[model samples]
Target: MTAVDPRRLPSAFWYLWTAVLINQLGGFVILFLSIYLTQRRGYSVAFAGLVVGIAYGGGGIVGTVLGGAAADRWGRRAVLLTAHLATAVSTVLLGIATGPLAITVAAFGVGAASNVLRPVAAAVIVDVTTPEQRPRAFALQFWAINLGFAVAAIIGSSVPDRHFVTLFVLDAAATLGAGLIIFARVQETRPARVDPAPGRGGGAVRGGGAVRQVLADRTFLVLVALAVLFGLVFMQHNTTMPVSIRQNGLPPATYGWLIALNAALIVGGQLLVPRLARHRDPAHLLAVAVLSMGGGFAVLAVTQQVWGYLLSVLIWTVGEMLHAAIMPTLVGALSPADRRGLYQGVFAQAFPIAALVAPAGGGWVMDHFGAATLWWCCLVLGIAGAAGHLVIGPARRRRLDMLEPSSTTIGVKARGT
Candidate 1:
């Protein structure tokens, strides 16, 4: 399969890419919110946990749906700028709030404000690129996110305890910088709305359109359900894996190094994804990715050794790389051009929802049934997810193929056909 050049993506995409990198680099608050709340703000651990889980997590989940609808109604550029600017403001508010109530509200704002960008940025990429260029485009965007995250993690760690406010300032500044870049460089990319036939009602209907359209899309809903399963298995690394490693007598630093390895592998291995996925069916790739992730955790079920843990990390990270790049494109392919933001938003919400559920679910399984049981469940879930994708993939492919002819004909006419 021939490689699609990333260089061919439009300037608008690059601007969006750069903005994403900047925003991610400044994403210091989420990583340290719990720590900051417990240590600096005099909040109890339980309170901090609640604040993070309920206020921030809930805000993030809500943001996707709101951001998607707003982007469809207003335009991608407006939503992107609003989210960035609002995040900047909220980060600063979180830094300065003295009371628990103030901090929680600010944190909620930060969460909602920041998460509003994910679907909008994804929609912009879809608007600017042809289907052929999309895989590479999303891959590059995913690479930027991880690259920024790696650097931010290092810089954030080096920050002094007394200088915690500095982190907030820096994060807000970076967010604003991203907003400025978008304001100056990026153009609105939402597809124009078309009126109904002359004999039809010709009335305008707004609000809840995205929700109705998305809910009615059974195939897309199936895809989202599969993603939730994959995410539940994948998110275990964050919640349960560390506990299991600690139970095995490994230090916290061991888990740290293992996670670092995951990041490093992604930073290095991600660029190859477009080429690796070239000319392949996305559903097939997604299935393989799910199996790899599930199998990785299943490896953890059998062994407690460091090498085994490392092997598990490697396998799951491979799945991460493959799934990260392809999933957005699949969401884009399935969505109508006009409602890309809403569709992307709904798709983006699947992981955060999984994140919310995985800890309790995996922890319960581990406590009652044992870690091995959880791992085995992951394997079963992975197989089930893969089978679902295989079943729905052909239908999605047929729908996309039907849409392609009209898109290609439009392109030809635009080129003076």
Candidate 2:
């Protein structure tokens, strides 16, 4: 594999990357929300799960679609700044709400505001970097996210339950800081109008046209479906895994450190796996990665000890590291330059889609059948998603070739790994 220097990427990417790291560092509330609800607020596990699903996932679905459209209609910088400010305000709202209704509404606000950043930020990355550089650019971005997450996990978990408000305030402050950075450093990168033909990846469409076009792309839809399945299996770590840890008699801090370990591994090795396997067929590599995730969660079904959970984290983290950089790059490759935000937005919805179903579904399953059953179901979902990816891989590659011929020709001396 060829080596690519991180410094070679444009300065805007670094600014965006730094802002992402800052946002994530203080973005610890979600990780501990379930725990906070169940242990601190005295909500039942099932109810907490419902609230998370409806508030976070439900709002995320709306925010994602709107944000994608807004990114295309407005500018990326504007959308990002607006969303960041909204996220900060909502985070504080969630912290102060007293009753269940207020809390749920506030959480929904946080979900919608925070999630709006996904498609726009992803669009910014696509806008600023060349195709050959995208993989490494995204890898670095993912690394920053997990690095912040690892630290947030430790800090959020270590604070006493009573001081959870401090976490919320800090999260809001960090979000504001990230927004200010974007306001200062990042510029508008939404592609200018090219041609009028939507079929040929041309200029931006007005009103519902972009949404209609993205929905019309059947191939991208299949990829989105695969992402949904992948997310379902992976999202269990937040929704169901914590409950499993507690049921096994492990403290919340144990879960925290375990999450930190997952991040540590990713931060340390995310760049390495992509470098080593850069030449492999991406579909085959992704299938193997998804299967590893399945196997890891499958192991979780039977393990009752911290060591067993640690092993589970190690296995799944490998899969996470491998797929992190490649998926978004594929989304960017598939999109027309003009509609990058919408395409990325539609793709981004897969996780929130999973979030919507997984928490509620996993909770119900665990409440009735047991945690083992839920983990086993994750294994099944992983296997199914892997098979689908294998079948669709060729079509996706052909589409990429048709859409981006220059993307395959590595002319840039500063090509990403």
Candidate 3:
């Protein structure tokens, strides 16, 4: 359409679709890594979890912030390319690692490097999409991820149950594939010509300074605190939840089904968020999401039946859809172009950091208090996140609006996707 119409919608959609395919395919290793460690490698559930949680969660925390900063300080394409290269190497290593230490190191590297792509890629979307079309663009990406997850789950289940290293090989190839597609086909979506402000240096990606910026923004800091808290809870799906499900008498396929359902809900919910977001700010939306997560987990505390747990998975998945879809959109909308990647990177660290603690803590809790107790932790963290979101309020919301990417009508410039 015209430059005046911020929702240059179609351009963003196609690109988003491509990103989703790459991301979903590259991501299967993360979902299936634990199965490899415990079922194939012969580690206890706790130890296998310790490695997975530490490797993925720890690496993700470090990478997100770094990726964002690199995107801002360098250029989006440069950082994204570097991230892909690193991801490819690390994922390949996972397939070949022979010992626990080597596997842990390899998994961590993969986790960190692979995660770097997300914040930077998101920043690109923020750089290109208009405020009005932002929701649709993000939904397109989210849908791709879930769709990919659906396909990955099918493959993961159909393959021999304990074929762990195969997942890594596939993950490695996916990263390379995504990079090739971008290098070969995905256009340089960021503006070719930039007008530099007097002191702002060259207009490059600028997010490494997120700690300073978040310090200045009272609301953003509060929101981060809440996210970190919720991560402590939600991370269970990867860490403790797997342990619990196995103990509680469900197969790995059960988790496959639950996660598939989770992805499906994410796709459905993200598509709806754009319409719903027009009527409500991200903070308000986040509040509802957090509350739903907390309430859902609390429901899990009392149930021991597989069917009962399935209902809990359903409840939590709904909340996940609302939160998962909107979070990046919020970050993209909050940071200045110079700092977009940095803020998102730093924001991404929360879950990874939580991954480090959640599994070990949950394992200890399960060892001592039993499986249901982990849900209590989730319950507390989710509620706190909701409250923290409530504190982020309307003024912070305005800053997010300003952050919506400026639109371009020039045929040379790529659209939001």
Candidate 4:
């Protein structure tokens, strides 16, 4: 098979990619949410952290699962349109909400509505692209996501404290705009639902069977576990990193620049890293990425200097560049064509689960044990995730072999061994 250039991805893909870029640019609320809760809303650090976890991670878990099913059942375009519109409303409410309870509810709604798009967008890409083109396709999407994030971070961090409302309003407008684009340009790509096999009658039975199939796949389960471990370490940038910078006497804007640095590195590295790693063993590449991520966090354990943190961000961002494109490609490879949305949804849940658990735990650790301890823990988790990836390599290969005995030959002949 000839290599597909990223530039030649389908026109439909570019439309969806543009929507992702626009949505992320407007979705600046997440960039400063923890700070917003604690600094602006006058909540305690731990409580603020809990709300962040609940809003993004908790809501994301529900959204991924339900959205995946909905995408499969109803259609990708419908889910995208509804999720984005609902999210826009929820975000606007979050911005204007004065009471703590109102803010918390809106935060959860925003998270749920915003995250439902992940699997649906992924499924759409998979729907439109061939297997060989998937890596570059996912890479392009990741690039768009980070490009928007980099811009959002810069703006989010630099905005005056009094005008935080502007951030939410812009984010809502962007989300609604993205929904409009999907409605206008993006066609529904969900494959027609398969009629259930001879004896299965109700929707419940088919849904149950899908769940069992996903749950029973040990190889996929292991991948999800490794992802969760990596996610725990990765999520600290949002939950604890801002507080750590403040504790070290740097202003909040410093945290924004640090995150912007991460986004910048991803934008710079994403295109090149995937092509370089394409020929290498994915499992080994994943191991290296996890270790690199750990090393970045470990750097923070010893130093509070801006350069030190920047260096750490550089390390992990490279790891991120490597991992982002590979994982989704693997999920797409592992899934049956018809069940791609369900499988992607299951895989997507790992990060949100990590997002949910990491902040509350990281916040508690920072509160009691100090930021150094939290960083050390991140290092340990990264190493453990690396080990998990190594063990998963053989298992994954065996599973692929069982699923498609010709995969090795096809992969080698087309790309590399």
Candidate 5:
């Protein structure tokens, strides 16, 4: 099969892609939550770190599972719309909330609502596109995400302390707008489920079976494990990275630029990398990506200068771009047609689970050990995760080969006229 071009993706994909762009562009809440907690709410840095962690990592884990199941059971458009509407409401509440309990609760709600979109969006693309189209489809989606994020980071970081509420309000408005788009244009793309036998338990049994099927896929399970490991290292950008930068005497604004750099590289590199690596084995690509991530962090262990930080950011940002392009495509490739959303959901959960642990754990490590030690730990995790992927690569390739002929047929049927 020929390589797919991003321009030729189905029009349905562009609608969902636009929604992703708008949703990410307006995603200012999480970006600023740590700063809001520390500067606006008067929480300690450590406490703020924990709050951000729990808000995103904790809530995301729950949302991914429920949303994934809901997408397969209900429909992709329905889940997307609901998640966006819920996110708008929760984001508004999070902005207005004052007390610790109120803030934490609102943050959790926002996270839960916001994260549901990830799998739903991914599954929608998988539903509409063929296997050959997946890499470019996902790459374009990642490009859009970073394009929005690059703009958001530059603008959101500049929001004045007194107008932080505006950030949240804008985020809510954008989310609501995305929901409207889905409501107006996007349709349910989940494959029609086969009816169960007459006395066979209904939705619950089917859902349970879907979950069990996903759990039983050893290749997918290994992928999820590696994702979680990489996620732990990856999440530090939002959590430990800023804190470490500040501790090293750089200003918070520096961290903002660093993040913007990350987004910029993704925006620039995402399209190019996928095209270049389109023919390579995904497992090997993933192994290389993980090593780059580890190497990026390893750079941090010794260097405290601005240049050093930028170099490290560049390294991991490349890894991140490659991972973004390859991962969803791999998930799409592995998933059965009717079970795509559930499979995507299970894969989606890995990062949030990592998020749940990474922030709190990184915070604890930074507080007790030196920042250098935290960087060292990240290096080890990255390398170890890379090694795991390498070990699993041959088996994963064999599984992909087994699934390819069947997946091709499913892809054809899935693209009904």
Candidate 6:
């Protein structure tokens, strides 16, 4: 687990990518699951939302750690393929579920299965990619995630009255296809022959050893704190922002437009930004993007105009892409190779933490204060995250600065290899 060829890293990217495309398509349909429960299946929004979050938060809790562990102990492909298959099955069942209990069980199944795949796949990226090249690698992931989400958003908006079961079936099929693609085309990207020794090169390079080592790093913990904070604000787009938009007399069309704008920007900008950022430290990219996100929210807080809100999406999209590209790369750089999955899993859970609180909190803020007030609050969170990065750069800048360049950017520090 000492080194890799930089050119080969790009080749490996394809295998990691196969699963994401499918998951994202499923994610789009999955987004409507709660709405289906409340509007179609005769449940309250509160109850439905809670049910949806259960799948999200609960599944992430189980999937994040376990997926990472599986990726390390076995290999990335094993964890990813199994997770996708399980989610595909769960999604179909969830669509046909009649009773709350049935839906609940299905939700748990989907949550457990879908939530874990990303973290393992992310670790796989670090396993194959070099440090200097990691920004582009993560940027590719960000683009892929949004690509799936964007398609999901489009499908959700178009099929308002369609049977919920149909969506579930479609999600299931998409996930299944993704799994098949991964199994058929993607090679196992796990580094060969882990050296399980402590202290010195690659910060204790050993299979399963890096997991414990990464969790032990105080600085890494601090970065996770910032990621969690970032999640709180980021989750607003999915949770509260749409609610606010609805309150403004806009229909669901407005909501679709908003997410579409952001997603498109991210998909288009992710690759470009990393190239521009190649000359600068990722910390700078992180700082700037975060500040822009805060600024966008602060602006949204001051305006009720549709155009203003749209502009805010464009602004926030830039920030979103920046963070998306940098964060995983940074995490990869700071980790030991053996423990990449564990650290990635830990970092993946940040979103769940935000999701667990955001819906209830964002919904409360909208009802109690107003959408503008929520934006103001988001502004605070985004700015705080931006500032926190100043305290902790994307990578251990001190460590990375010492590495010599080769055809391969063996990011042992970043990937924890």
Best by TM-score: 2
* True lDDT of residue 235, candidate 1: 76
lDDT of 3 by residue, 1-417 (tens): 213465556554365468558757557677777777788778787777778777777888889887877776667777777788898888888878879889889878987997887777777776666655556666777778887887787677667855666777787787777777666655555544555433223454333344565557655556666777777777777766766778777877877777777776676666775565554556667878887777676776898677776788778776777776676656655555566667777777777777888778877887888777767777777777887776656556544434323421111111222
TM-score of each candidate structure, all chains considered together: 0.84, 0.94, 0.87, 0.93, 0.92, 0.88
- Compose the digit string of candidate 4's lDDT tens values, residues 30-145: 88988887778788888788778976678889889888878887889999999999999999998898787887788888878888999999999988776667778788899999
Q: What is the lDDT of residue 23 in candidate 2?
A: 99
Q: Of the candidates numbered 3 and 6, which has the greater lDDT value?
A: 6
Worst 10 residues of 2 by lDDT: 408-417
Ten contiguous residues with the weakest lDDT in model 3? 408-417
Off by over 4 Å in 6: 1-10, 195-212, 399-417
After best superposition, candidate 3 residue 323: deviation in angstroms? 1.5
lDDT of 5 by residue, 221-241 (tens): 888989999999998888888
**Candidate 2: where is the Cα deviation over 4 Å?**
1-7, 195-201, 408-417
Give one digit per residue, the lDDT tens place, for model 1 in 287-386.
8999999999999889989999999999988989989977876776667766778888889888767756675678778888999999999999989988
Q: lDDT score of model 3?
A: 0.69
Candidate 2 lDDT, 43-162, residue by residue in tens: 888878877888889889888889988998888999999999999999998888778998899888988989999989988988878777777888899999999999999999899998
TM-score of candidate 6 against the unseen true structure: 0.88
**Minimal lDDT window, size 10, model 1:** 408-417
lDDT for each candidate structure: 0.78, 0.84, 0.69, 0.82, 0.81, 0.72
On lDDT, the leading prediction is 2
Ranking by TM-score: 2, 4, 5, 6, 3, 1
Q: Spell out the clash pairs found in candidate 2.
A: none
Which is superior by lDDT, 4 or 5? 4
